[model samples]
Target: MSIYRKDIYVFDGDRPVKALIRSYTEADFEGLIRIQQESFPPPFSPELWWNEEQLGNHVRLFPEGALCVEIEGELAASMTGMLVNYNPGDPDHSWVEMTDAGYICNHLADGNTLYVVDIGARPAYRKLGLGKWLMLSMYEVVVRLNLQRLLGGGRLPGYDRVADEMSAQDYVQAVIEGKLKDPVLTFLLRCGRTPVRLMADYLDDEESHNYAMLMEWRNPFLPQES
Candidate 1:
């Protein structure tokens, strides 16, 4: 129930560090918590962080979709997701409902869409392409599961800097057009994910103005239906 990728590496300044991306194990519980806390600071409620039960449920529901990364024998990053089915025209769930308030509620195995519930990297590992690596790794899961696409909500961390100057949609459009840089959504866009719409009250982060960008990344290899 683990995927081992040997070729992935991220650089800390000029030092090249190899990272092992694999499925979660019972032993990784503490490491996951530490990294989660480091990646997401305060303002995210305590209930939003991963606990043993929630992590265990994710492993039980979809082991292949639950993955972690290790660098120099230390757990540095992780990504969790679940299978779901929804109409492309209207997605009914927000980040809270889809992830069971960040714990992942119901995972539909027969569903064609792979929902990225959560993902984070250690502070020291930021800007090293680790997040992008993990995201691309999720795409591998989608292909292996024969899913239609990958979907998730991206936090607008840069919103607070210019909220009074523009609307959320305007901010998103600015990011897409390269007029502004959102630490989260811009990177997602660079990774080939498209912003579908703005989601209100998606999470508790005040930095994003309690908003998020609903995004999607289709599997290019999958056949399209007319």
Candidate 2:
């Protein structure tokens, strides 16, 4: 726990980073789509991002808080709030149809869990701590709602386990060699999120090369600021 407490503050790095965390707005939807399109594959359509953006907005309606961050006047990042008791009728809740939806649904069929559904940082400004800042912002929001934990599916690329393909294995090796930034998973760990890879076989289908990992945060509070 103490090891992770230190992870919350800005490290001694140089990137001219300044983050402002706040709620999602109607005006911010398109910008959010732009950010998502830049960071991941099979990116969300404007309509999809718009719907997900609205879902993220639900964090504010609950005792739980949600936030988006603007860095240097650009919509740099967003942290969607999760519902602790996720009954659709309960405040604001969401269930998505993803490539792995069926697998994840059957895998963890019964439960009430809050998840950080959408998290992405702009490409150019990535590797800076801005992403972590956004994550900690979400962490604070979870605690404010007095929620015990958060849940979500994280980095599910086409090749999760089998790195037989040179390109795919190279990518994994790059991560081992410190050449790639596993920002999302790293942030999940720093927040003490435990992730389980679900639907590992989906990688066989190139189109559905989607790999999903479940990230759980048992204690959703940030380390006290000294």
Candidate 3:
């Protein structure tokens, strides 16, 4: 079955550019890396970007979990994920631990949670609806697979500005209260994910002070625990 497909618009320059959302393939590996490069430029370690081996693993392990948006044959955005038996009791986890350093080696086929490894768009495509569409597409996967929820560690990219003034918990509370806006966290919130808790050393992002927020979007159809 096809992962997802839809017509979308990317507000790049003077006009809205037409785009298509669909499951990515092995052929798009280089394009995906380019998207990451543009999304996270220099100062963001190049070694952290998706490599050929990781992309190969993603396609081989869970092809349906890899989705991307393309503009006239150009890959503009992507979101990669895999299933896992999530443990709610232990919510604290680093990106490296969960994602297996982006290779997603721990993916469990029968797991109830679809854990997102990464989601990003090219610089020019940022703030557009592309990211949201990519997220929604993954949510669709949760429904199709009859999973419990979608989970991920989202960066608090705007936290550093107030790091010395308040605690990470306080900062997350501010975002939840709508008193502040974070580049990454705010976007995830807007996409319907509920904040779980603030996680420390989640990533190496200086802007986030290496903090992240564990977020989740529950499957509405999941049966209540009996």
| lDDT scores of the candidates, listed in order | 0.85, 0.50, 0.87
Off by over 4 Å in 1: 1-7
Between which residue pairs do clashes occur in model 3? Answer: none
RMSD of each: 1.7, 8.8, 2.0
lDDT of 1 at 128: 78
Residue-by-residue lDDT tens digits, candidate 3, 162-205: 98999999999998899999988899989999888888998887
The numbered model that scores best in lDDT is 3
Between candidates 1 and 2, the TM-score winner: 1
Each model's TM-score? 0.94, 0.61, 0.93
Worst ten in a row by lDDT for model 2? 1-10
Steric collisions counted per model? 1, 1, 0
Query: Cα deviation of 152 in candidate 2 (Å)?
Result: 0.6
Ranking by TM-score: 1, 3, 2
Candidate 2, residue 134: Cα displacement in angstroms equals 1.8
Where model 3 places Cα greater than 4 Å from the true spot, the runs are 1-3, 9-16, 224-226
How far out, in Å, is residue 153 in model 3?
0.3
